[model samples]
Target chain A: GDSVTQKEGLVTLTEGLPVMLNCTYQTIYSNAFLFWYVHYLNESPRLLLKSSTDNKRTEHQGFHATLHKSSSSFHLQKSSAQLSDSALYYCALSDRYGSSGNKLIFGIGTLLSVKP
Target chain B: EAAVTQSPRNKVTVTGGNVTLSCRQTNSHNYMYWYRQDTGHGLRLIHYSYGAGNLQIGDVPDGYKATRTTQEDFFLLLELASPSQTSLYFCASSSNSQNTLYFGAGTRLSVL
Candidate 1:
C-alpha cells in the first residue's frame, strides 16, 4: 500500500516571503513518482512538479521540489511567494507496478494563503 | 491544454436516488479515473478504467459503479446516492499509468 502525507493543513505567509510545504510518502515500489499539484479557487488541479529520480530537484512555476528517497520526502518550496500563489497544494505518489492503472495516492493537502 | 470535460457542474439528488457523472476526454488518453475530494481525505480514488470496456475498483469503490464505453468517455454512477456521498468529484485522464493526469473542472454533488 502506498500513502502520502502533507504535514501542514494550512500555511499563511506574506507576499514576497519564502514558502515550503512538506510532503512525504511511503511506498514499496522501486520506481515511484512523486508529484505536486496546485488547485486554485475555481480551477482544476494541475501538475506543478514531479520527480522519480531520487535526490534530483524538479522546478516549475517558481516552485521547486526535490525527491529524497532516503527520507521518502518530496517537499515543495518557493523562493518568493506571490499573491497568486495562494491555493490548495496536494502531494501525490504513484508507482510503476500497479496492476490496474497508475492510480495516485494523495495527501490531505495544504492550503497556502499568501497575503499582501 | 489537455481537455477533460465533466458534465453537470453542480448536481443535487435525494437519498437513494440515481445519479450519473459523465466524463469525456479529448486527449485520447488510455486511462481515466474518478476521485472524490472531501475536507480531510483529500482526493480518494473511487474508480478507474484502463481502456474501453475496462473497469477497475479503486481505493473507495464500495458505493460507486463506473463504466468506460469508449476511449474518450467514462461514466461514474451512484445507484443509491447517500448524504455521505456528497463531495466534489473530479475526473482525470492520462496517457498511461505512469503519466501526468489532466483533470476536469470538477462536479459538486450533494445528496440530501
Candidate 2:
C-alpha cells in the first residue's frame, strides 16, 4: 500500500510572502507519480501540478514541486503567495506508469490561508 | 471544458436505507474513481473502474458496491447505509497517465 503525508493542516501567510507546503510519500514502487491538487471552498479538488521524473521540477499556476527520490519527498513551493492561492491542497501518489495506471492515493489536505 | 458531473449534490437518509450515487464523465477517460473526504482526513479511495463493465476494489470498499455500466457512467451503491458513512463523496475521471484528474462537484450524504 502507498501513502502520502502532507504535514501542514493549516498555513496562514500574508500576501506577497513565500509559501511552501511539505509533502512526503512512502511507497515501494520506484517510479511513483507525485501530484498536487487544489480545492477551493465548495469545489472539487483540481489537479495543480504533477511529476514522475526524479529531480525534475514541475510547475503550474505559480506553484512547483520536484520529486526527490533520494529524499522520498515531493514538496510544493511558491515564491509568493496570492489571495487567490488560498485553498485546500493535497498531495497524491500513483504506482503505475502511463495512462493505464490511473489509480491514485491521496494525502490529507492542507488548508492555505492567504491574508491580503 | 473537461467535466465529471455527479448527481444529488446532497442527500439525507435514515439508517438502513438504500442509496445510490451516480457519476458521469464527458472526457472519454478510461478510469473512473469514487472517494470520500472526512474532516481532518485525506480523501480515501472507495472504488474505481478502468472501463465499461470493469470494477476494482479500492482501499475503502466496505459497505459500498460500484458498477461501470458504460464508458461514461459509474455508480456507487450504499445498501443499508449507516451513520459512519456520512461524508462527502467525489467522483473523478482521468485519461490514463494524464496525471490530471477531472473531479465532480461532490455529494454530501448524511445518515441519521
Candidate 3:
C-alpha cells in the first residue's frame, strides 16, 4: 500500500518570507508520480504541480517542488510567500505504470497562512 | 479551462436516508473520482470510474455506491447515510493516467 505524509498541520509566515512544506511518501511501485494540490476555503483542491523524475524540480505559480527518491520526499517550496498564497496544500502519489488507473494517495494536508 | 461541476452545493439529510451527489465534466475526461474531506483525513478516495459503464473500488468504498452512466457524468450514492458521512464531498476529472485533475466546488453534506 502507498501512503503520503505531511507532518505540518499549519504553517504561518509573513509576506515575502521563504516557505517550505514537507511531504514524504512510502510506496512499493517504481517510477511513481508525485503531485501538489491547493485548495481555498469552500473550494475543491486543484493541481498545482506534479513530477516523478527524482531530484528534478517542478515549479508553478512561484512555487517549486523537487522529487527526491533518495529521501522519499517531494517538499513544496516558494522563494517568497505572498498573502494570496494562503490555502491548504496536499501532496499526492500515484503508480500510473502499474495499471492502477493512476489512483492517488493523498496526505493529510498542510494549511498555509501567509500574512502581511 | 477545464471545468468539472457538481450539483447540490449543500445538503442536509437525516440518518439512514438516501443521498446522491452528481458530477459532470465537459472535458470528456476518461477518469473521474469521488473523494471525501474530513478534518483529520484530508481527503480519501471513495470510488472512481475509468470510462463510461466502468467503476472501481478505491481506498475507502465501504458506505458508498457509484455509477458512470455516460462519459461525462458520474454519480455517488449513499443509500444508508450515517453521521459519520457528514463531510465535504468533491468530484474531480482527469484525462489520462498521471494527468492533472480539475476539481469541482465541493458539496457540503450534513447528516443529522
Best by TM-score: 1
Query: What's model 2's lDDT at A8?
Result: 88
Two-way DockQ contest, 2 vs 3, winner: 2
Q: Taking the tens digit of each residue's C-alpha lDDT, what string does model 1 give over A55-106? A: 9889998999999999999999999999999999999998864344778899
lDDT of each: 0.93, 0.92, 0.91
Kindly give the stretch of ten consecutive residues in candidate 2 chain A with the minimal lDDT sum: A95-104
The residue ranges of model 2 lying beyond 4 angstroms of the native Cα positions read none
Q: Candidate 1: global Cα-lDDT?
A: 0.93
B98: Cα error in model 2, Å: 2.3
Tens digit of lDDT per residue, candidate 3, span A8-68?
A: 9999999999999999999897788899999988767898999989899899999999999
lDDT of 2 by residue, B83-106 (tens): 999999999998875757799999
- Residue-by-residue lDDT tens digits, candidate 3, B11-108: 99999999999999998889999999987689899999999999999888999999999999999999999999999999998877446778999899
**Candidate 1 residue lDDT tens string, B10-64:** 9999999999999999998999999999988899999999899999999999889
Candidate 1 has a TM-score of 0.97
- Superposed model 1: Cα runs more than 4 Å off: A97-100
Docking class of 1: medium
Assess every candidate by TM-score.
Answer: 0.97, 0.96, 0.96
Q: Which pairs in model 2 have colliding backbones?
A: A99-B96, A99-B97
